[model samples]
Target: MVERRPAGLRHSIKKQMAAVFSLLMMGTILLCWFINNFFLGEYYISKKQNAMFATYQILNMAATNGTLSTDSFDIEFQKNCGKYNINYILLDAESKTLKTSTPDYSTYSQRLLNNLFGENAEHQKLLETGEKYEIQIAEDDRTATEFLEMWGVLDNGNLFLFRSPLESIRESVKLANRFLGEVGIASAIISAVIVYLISRQITKPIEELTGISERMIHLDFDAKYTGKSRTEIAQLGQNINELSYTLEQTISELKSANNELQRDIERKNKIDEMRKEFLANVSHELKTPIALIQGYAEGLKEGISDDEESRNFYCEVIMDEAAKMNNMVKKLMTLNELEFGNEKVEMERFDIVALIRNYLQASELLCRQKEIEVIMEAKKPVYVWADEFMIEEVFGNYFSNALNHIAGKRVIDVKLNRHDNLVRVSVFNTGEQIPEDSLPHIWDKFYKVDKARTRAYGGSGVGLSIVKAVMEALNQKYGAVNYDNGVEFWFELESAGEKVDDEKGMETEESQNG
Candidate 1:
């Protein structure tokens, strides 16, 4: 279990994520405000300038060309002023209003005109002179109302004013700011939540790995990372998990080795006694084969009895004994490697059922010769995790043992039992049941089940021992069960695909019930 961090810790990932999101959102809001305050005004000014220039061209064309009469000109002037939101008064040299586009006399533009002229003859004369004048009406301390007025003398010497208000842009900017505020608040809230959640996801594995490391520092190998993801952090966690397992296994092996070493050092007498016993057994085992070979070779060289068939027979015996010795030595070497933990078990997924069938097929000649019926009970493949080579050796040993020992009915039955995440294969032959006293000693090296049998029928007696070593190396259970009819040798391997079929079976059962 991981301890809770202090509540006052400020460098939490959630806070960091929130801070970064806040900065990004705030920067966006600031940029919106900057564009509204600075560039928006220029944008509005440019639009106003274009509208004024377009209106001037229309009015000047109508007045200069013969395209419009006085009445038609007044209609065109009202249309342009209404479309562009302009209010104006067209005046003659005496300041008489020929046409006015303003519906109300109290408009800001009209009020400005009143304030600028105020019945002053000189001011009226100056404004009517074919010159342009622009003014601003103060609305508040932060804002003002602007109007552009152009005074131009028509070709007939009549004067007119074109006034367009620029205050509509201020309200637009205000509306934009209000919208920006609402959106910015919502964005900040959402981004903060999203970033915080993402940060937790990224940091959760790191925290788990840290806790696992702390436990590992104290030599606890069982604190493994159990989280699953496709991210690099998850991959790192998986690697650390494998490392912990490897460390645990390595340490366990080292401790066992050290204990064995200490025992060996303490019991020098027992070591000497075991060494003597081992050498005696090896010498005794080698003596018969070597003596037979030596005698046969001498007989062949001396041409004893001077018969070709007899010489060939002697040579065959020597060669057969030499082969037996070779097989025994090979088994011994394999046993030594397994017992010393020098052999590396390469694990992979394979169909154990298929392997059993292939081995049975390979031994068909022997089965035929022995008049034995090999029966494999399974049809579908049973996928299991194990060293394929080691499993092959295991199956070969069991099969060979069964063939040599078959008696009644001469039947060999191979059964595969698959359970939760594991598969156990058993080889049973119809033969004499193994003796009760020999059940526990059957896996010992060179301990023959049939003591009367020699190298021709009985093996070096290391097959079962090798099976035990390999099974133990894989950390699984394996043993033999002596039945009334025959002996059943069985061993289990870890499986990778057990749950799939089970799930499918469950679904089928559920559907049937439904």
Candidate 2:
């Protein structure tokens, strides 16, 4: 089954990062707005109070020095009043104006007198009190405006009053908070978009890695992480690439091992089947010879063949049966070695034409005794590559089989024909055509088409089987073909061509007359 990601998690990292960054920015802006709303007014008032106290100290010092009306004192006092946005009025012990920064001195003096006498106290909130001074937030009854006011008695028994307007400061604080809110909202939106874009850049590699892992799940190891950065993400990509390579190699090795194991299993099964078939064929083939040998020996022991000729025939029959059994056993051993790969083939360059002629020459007497005509068509050397001894065995089996089955025209034809890079040696004999169905089984051990005829001629039916084994060992082709006149058996070997040096100086004569 395919794996799937949770619905909520898809593409969430970018969004989450953008959200978190925007929240932090907006939170900082909100905190600033909150401070502006709750504390800015008090801070402004405190700074104004400090300015007023400094001015008062300067004025008190001047009055003590009797320089309150001097030009330098007037200049300094006027500058302080303007800088602190304060309006001040000073009165003598007789209630006459001594120095004033505002033209409305009478009005300020009345207000100060009212404050000193505790009149209009219900309209004032006291902020601080001292032996010589008191600070309060008071409202102007006519204008409904508030002021941060300081009134005190001078050392000379004179009165001084200082006041600054509080309305503008409150408006500034509110305006600042509103402006912060506006900027914070705009910054949050723009920062969110920028953060989202940056987050996509960061998450792109992670998404690619996820895709690679998905492909790996399906056993496809082709996808790879190609990022070249030195970040942790890049390191992870390199690790994943290595993991993919390792897994691909491991899986390939496993598949190879599995295939080898399967081949071994099939080979084992084939060997077991061949073994069973071999045992059955061997038992069947040996039975008749063993029974004959036993029966004849028993007759001799019982005096059933008392005559000298009869006794000699009995002994000869036993020896012949024993020899056949011995020959059959040797052939069986040779076949076994070839089939089991115990016998190694020695490949060498040799003239196939000369080999055939020499074999026919060796069997010329047998051919004459059978009164069969033998024919060979090649007159030149046909050099080929093969295991010389094994090829000879193959040729010998074909020739013998053809001779044993020779009939009708009583002629044997041996031909060496070349096709492409191979030489085909065919042995044909005039005889009854091998049955079509039995042709396929002719190469099986101990499979005879006519059992009675095979027994009459002492044919063991293992020659073709040996031929099959030898040809297979040499990795060549061998087969039989049926014609109207007879059957032709053929085998092929790799051609060495006439260019090879004739080390044996062997030459083939024209067609041999039998």
Per-prediction TM-score = 0.46, 0.52
Clashing residue pairs in candidate 1, if any? none
RMSD, one per candidate, in order? 21.2, 14.6
Weakest lDDT window of 10 consecutive positions for candidate 2: 505-514
- The lDDT of each candidate is 0.73, 0.88
In candidate 1, which residue ranges exceed 4 Å CA deviation? Answer: 1-278, 499-514
Each model's total of backbone clashes: 0, 0
lDDT of 1 by residue, 262-319 (tens): 8888678655765675677678789888999999898878778587788889988988
- Candidate 2, 377-423: lDDT as tens digits: 56677788999998899999999888889999899988766556777
Cα misplacement distance, residue 21 of candidate 1 (Å) = 74
Output the TM-score of candidate 2.
0.52
